[model samples]
Structures are given as C-alpha cells and as structure tokens.
Target: MSEWVDVHFQALETCGKRARSAANMLTVEDVFQDSSAKKPADAAQASMFGDLSHSGALAGKVNDVWSALKEELGTGRSRLQGVEKAIDQVETNLRKATKAATV
Candidate 1:
C-alpha cells in the first residue's frame, strides 16, 4: 500500500474506534411519562406552590433524555460501521489496482 493510503486508512480505523467509544458511553434508561402532579402534603406550601407532586418527574425527564441519546448513539454506531466497510472496500480496490499494474 502507498504511504498516503496507509495513513488515511489508519486514520479511519482510529475514527471508528472513537465513534464506537462514544456510542458506548451513552446509556439507555427506562423513560416514563410524568403523571398528574399530586397535591402537596404541606397545606400551606401546597396553597403557596400549588401542585408540585412529581417525585418521579425529574427522574422521568432524565431517563427520557438518556434514552433519546442512546438512540442517537446507535445511529452513530451504524455510521461507524459504514465508514469501516468503505475503508475496507477502498483498500481492496487499491490492492487490485496494484496487482493489475504489476501483472
């Protein structure tokens, strides 16, 4: 392989590794919808603040974001696979060209 092609292919391999790592870093969680906010226990606070019931709301929102990010990460992983396959095809074509020239 020519030095230029070799370098470019190596760079692709490195990029693929980085992409995979990034995908793995995003974790999926059980996302849920926020239920109706319940009335607060503190009657005075409840009156002052109204319904603020959601103990689960914050968790649900976080999980929802995590799940979305995980899906996006899966798409990125698929793109990385495509890049790897394209690199392989390019290398194969280069080798074939070199063989034909020598023959």
Candidate 2:
C-alpha cells in the first residue's frame, strides 16, 4: 500500500510539473500573436489540458495536488486575460497620445 501511495504521489508531482510547463508555453504563445487584437478567454482555457495525461488520477484527487493545479491554471488564465486587456488599453492610449502630439 505504501509503495502504491508513493507511486501515485510521484505521478501527481509529475503531472503538476508538466501542467506548469505547459501553462508557461501557453502564456508565451498567447502573447506572441501576430495581430494586436485581444484573444478570447477560451484561448487561455485551451491550455489547461495540454499536459494532462491521466484522467483517472485527476478524477481521484488522492493527493489534492490536482485540485491545486487546476486552481493555478485558472488563476493563470485570468491573469493572462487581464494582461491582454491592459495591453489593449495601453495601445489605445498610445495611439491617442500620438494623435494629440501630431495635432
């Protein structure tokens, strides 16, 4: 039983690490778009499953790390949306500033 627990714990850790890495990649990709238009929030949602390999383990939540990772991803997605919105606002302000300067 102990060995089995250890195995599952290691698996959970590995999943968390992979999820974190994928989250990083998604973040970079989301920000690196060719166009300046804001992406949908669902675009961020699309990243949440990139690293998930074990549906059974995720459903079990035996170690509770899976839940934590889900929360982390959710927070990361929200942060990405906020950053995108801020970027749009900044770009708009810059355009206005440039126009005013030209005037």
Candidate 3:
C-alpha cells in the first residue's frame, strides 16, 4: 500500500503569478515618487527651522524612507522570482518521479 500526495500545480502557479505582479506594481516609480504631501512637509519644517542650519528636514526624511521602501520592494521582487523558479523545479522533479514510479 502506498500513500498518495496531492499537489495543485495550477493553484501554485496562480499564487506565484499574483505575488510577482504585486511586487512589480510596488516597484513602479509612480507609487510614492513626488507624493503631494512632501511639499507641505517641507514647508512645515522650514517654518519651524527658520534658517537655523537645521539638518532634520521632514521632507528629506520622508524621501529617505520612501527610497528605502522602494529598495526593499525590489529586493522582495527578486526573492519572489527565485521562489517561483524553485517551485517550478520542484514541480518538474515531482512529475518526473511520478512518471518513473508509474512505469
């Protein structure tokens, strides 16, 4: 007697495709670039600093945060691609093994 294992390849592929699409969408330039709030943040910071040679502008900080987030999204996208490839290889190997066993 042999135990049976069920794998849904279609579902796996669909999930991978959706994840990749989401990651790609986040990495697009328009997501957070030139956000409208930035101008107001800069103005507010300027009013508080009033030419005191301050280095803590809210707008700059916000930009740095956005840059870091974009970089992270890019990294996540790469990782998702690697994961999808690994899943494909696993599916192929499993199919080959199953065919060999059936024969």
TM-score of each: 0.50, 0.41, 0.58
> What is the clash count of model 1?
0
RMSD of 2: 23.0
Q: Which residue pairs overlap in candidate 1's backbone?
A: none
lDDT (Cα, tens digit) per residue for candidate 1, span 1-103: 5787678767766776675665454333221224355322432322343465863565566556655666886777677667666766776677688668868
Instruction: List residue ranges in candidate 3 displaced over 4 A.
Output: 1-7, 30-60
| lDDT (C-alpha, whole model) for all candidates | 0.59, 0.54, 0.64
Using lDDT, give the best candidate's number.
3
Model 3 TM-score (2 dp):
0.58
Candidate topping TM-score: 3
Off by over 4 Å in 2: 1-63
lDDT (Cα) of model 3: 0.64
lDDT of 2 by residue, 5-103 (tens): 456546555655555555565443445467687543432332354576874455455335534655666688666555555655655565576568768
lDDT of 3 at 81: 78
